[model samples]
Target chain A: MLVRVKSRYRPVAMTAAEAMDGRVRRRERNAALLYDAAAELLATRSLDEISVEEICRRAGVGRATFFRIFETKEGLLREFNRRLTADAAARIDAAGDIDLRAALGHVRDAIIEAWGHAGPGHASMALTYAYHAPERIHDPHPELYALVRQRIERAMASGEIPGVVPASLAASLAVINLTAPVAWTLSHRADELDELSGVLLDQWYAGMISTPKPDRRRNGPRP
Target chain B: MLVRVKSRYRPVAMTAAEAMDGRVRRRERNAALLYDAAAELLATRSLDEISVEEICRRAGVGRATFFRIFETKEGLLREFNRRLTADAAARIDAAGDIDLRAALGHVRDAIIEAWGHAGPGHASMALTYAYHAPERIHDPHPELYALVRQRIERAMASGEIPGVVPASLAASLAVINLTAPVAWTLSHRADELDELSGVLLDQWYAGMISTPKPDRRRNGPRP
Candidate 1:
């Protein structure tokens, strides 16, 4: 009984924190490499036609590595969207307590910058993907949706905006207003952005708040 | 010598009215046949997966005949859309001088009815095609777009609405609003046709006339 039994030799299990941290770093690096390649390939061809091999070659990663990170081409596309959406969300979240006009302008400017830097082909691909990927677009990382929704709800609660409209609908409309201009720009009608954004903002604020602007009469002779 | 031409051998072009009528009748017949076949086949397969041969076989038409009528599968799909859009346009146009709310309600009712009559599978296929089609949802049909734009512009002119939001944006939004709800419905969501239609009408009117409603306050409140 005094003698200790010899234990079998075994590898020690990694701590949960260590495992998670390593996994997270690996995922982030792989995703960055994939996106860099995707952005480059997208610049030359439409998304529908771009093959996984091309992306892998461009990223200087093997097929196995690519597959280890992304399940499919669409998965890679979603990753790219996730990053951009997160960036935009961060910017929007940072500008807390701003006026509606200024806040919306900030959102609009961020969206424009994102779209502009996305380059023409990548922008078109992202738009086309968004159009076809309804489920993805609606829930492309629900955390972002939740954050945006909470911010909008908080704004509504502040009475800076007046609306009985459901928070979800208002969020959806804000999204539509922000993205619709990009859809037009993707079609090469870039000149329409300023005018379209103005119209959209006016409609959103005036319609939602039911605020009567005295200048309405100035737009035309009262109909 | 030319006077010796036989009456039976001479080719005769139909008059403009007669030709147009005949063309319409032919189109109607072909569409009915194709629609029936498509509805039946779509129960088990997608439009992309279905072949021209299969569509023709199901329709009891020859491959050549199918091609003669529809240049491609996309063309056939477009024809189906054209029928639906035309029907919607006719209904909307008939409700002349109706307020934006009523007119939109009528259009919604018509669309719901049309969708109701379609088999669930066919409705799904149509939605998929509409989403993926090259043309943005409403623009492919100039006639429909023009009619919708005119109605929006008229609504704005009526001073019942107060802003200069482009008629085009209003028209596009109207189409998207109507389509989005129905598209959502197809997925078996917590949506009733009448309720969704009502929300859409409310949003459209609010957006169009810059009318502030209680719901607008529910959007993010200004800090």
Candidate 2:
């Protein structure tokens, strides 16, 4: 004989949780659409020329939705910037644990790949604007810095690298040197960014690893 | 015997030339005064916050003279930036023909000294602004880049450096790395700028010279 058991409405609780998850996913999707629209517009227009209305239109979202996600156009742009930095940081993390040379190469490739989404011209301009803002440039991208510091520490501890420089300083130097060429290429040859970036990393890493004495003879007279 | 030929009105001609020279000098003095005043004001305020009237008042010059020297307030700021870069370049040239280490030291010193004129906060802000503007950041500072390139070429040619990197790429790396640290110090700890800059250069240079095998052990763990 089977006893009749009363069944609890567990499906009701599951439905509520699923609804909450669906709401979150919807919000994320809306924000992503807006970000993508802004990036597309920003690729051709300056920040000043971009409007929230146009972004909403391109994103297929209402003005109310846009406002719910972002406070202002500048705020939206800042969000985009933050997202880019975060994505690059994520890439850096993903590329970690490679040998020093491969690690640097992977990191560079990650940055370039992330930047390519915005196109060279837009990426260059965005970086230029961010650099001029009052905020500390490196503070927004702690992951990248941590990656550099970690690489330097590992290289130092294993006696795999020649430099006696502190990890922090070396990391800073690597950040700047590796970045300048990409900026240079963006200004001079956007199409050649990949090639120039490779050249910069190759030459810089070579110099970093090669031991040589300062020559006494090159104090040649200036013209 | 003094031979007095036909009077050629030499005194009158000399007077005209001297008057012209004096007028030019006065104009230059007025412009310099305006620049100094702007620099002082920019130290404490953003460029947008600075007004033409306030600048003229601080400079003790008429607004007309300010306009005469500079088309707009932005123009004045650009000129100021240009002057600072030129001064640094001039110092780099003056410090040329030294040994590899000394040349780098002198160049670094020259750059720091030139930057020292503006309080660190102002200097850092100015650089931040310059980086964002549409104008090319490196164009106005051609001399600085040339100096770096020249040094690298000399070092490479004389076999003073162990690395076989191209001169141009190496130079870009040097410029970016060196400047980034000074900029960092300005915002983070202005008082310790000199000391921090020295450490940065020392470590970076050491890394550039030391030969090390890329360590393969640390690529063991990925976070």
Candidate 3:
């Protein structure tokens, strides 16, 4: 669990636990400052236009400090994305012992709320991730995938989503279909970003992916 | 109908009809030469590394002539994509009032065959199209969508795939899912490009794109 921080640093000597706590708080505060600065800068300018020095200066943090927190500028966006997924994962976990459909509703609602605030910064982040390393279908955003995998496994145990298809593909399929709008916003339909993700997510939750291992033969044996 | 040309031009004076024929032939030849040269160079070099002058030089065509033939290098790619869609559309049309699933099988086979020979040129072409202008979910690959729309209408006419969903959405869904591999080739799973498209297409063929309206209420009124 991340301990949210309030202040940057204190020079006075203290107990080892107190010192570690101060370090954690300072680290988190710096990360939060850098993220806010990046978002503010990216609101009016493209990623290429914003320099690291500007972000550091705006955050009131040293350049070396910024580097210590994030390996690259994109690391900030990735960390933010990780938080969003973690939030949704927690919700999915909280839905324990409930129906699968209701659990997926949490996933859909999480996306809707997230994209509601998405600006050019978010769009650029998504594009960078896509171009640098496309999400692997087998495993992507591992923690969230792991949680969703467990959910699917439970569904399969109950035979809700058809136990025939492997739980792995089902989870990946569900995750990718649900998350497609992030990458899609970089396209011409960007204007429809907020609305489209909602629609796609709704459609996904409404019906399961075609999991029935229907006559795969008539398709002529996978070319 | 496209008149495939064998050679560039012959300047001998001829009748008006012959002159028109020569112009069409020369125009097509120029476009083909540029496409082939672009593909050959792209095989070894990234798109950013190659220049228009180099492409023209390799094609033995002048820069002015290249510009006349293609609005932009990306335009050449768009045309190639157009050709691929045209070929698929032709096959779909020739299916001529056949069963819907069987016709869809023709669409799947067409994608598999095309991707088998896809190279970096095809991958770059897909990315350019994806970034510049996304295919509208309402209408994509116009010629192919039109034909598939008609086919879906015919199926609905016979109540085959069920007439609940609009033929327009169904056709668009089919086209987008079918062509997903072209854009997907840019991802890390690119090695599976040829194989994955085959599977997705088969899944699509085996089942419809969730045409059933199903209980949308349980998903919480679309966020």
DockQ of all predictions against the true structure, Cα-based: 0.07, 0.05, 0.03
C-alpha lDDT of all candidate models, in order: 0.49, 0.48, 0.51
The residue-by-residue lDDT of candidate 2 on A1-223, one tens digit each, is 0001111112323445787877666777887778778778776776667778888999998888888877666455455434433443344456654332222222223223333344433544444454332224333234344545555666666666655344666666654544444334333433443334434344445545554333311111211
Query: Which model, 1 or 3, shows the larger DockQ?
Result: 1
lDDT of 3 by residue, A154-221 (tens): 66676555554445554555445433443354333334333444444444433444554344222112
Which candidate wins on DockQ? 1
> In terms of docking quality, how is candidate 2 classified?
incorrect
Of candidates 3 and 1, the better by TM-score: 1
* lDDT score, candidate 1, position B171: 66
**Local lDDT at A35 for model 3:** 76
| DockQ for candidate 1, C-alpha atoms | 0.07
- lDDT per residue as tens, model 1, A69-138: 7776656545543443344344545776443223323322333334435444564564454333333343
Candidate 1 chain B: worst-modelled 10 consecutive residues by lDDT: B1-10
> Interface root mean square deviation of every model, in Å?
18.3, 17.3, 18.3
Error of 3 at A204 (Å): 10
Candidates sorted by DockQ, best first: 1, 2, 3
TM-score for chain A, prediction 3:
0.51
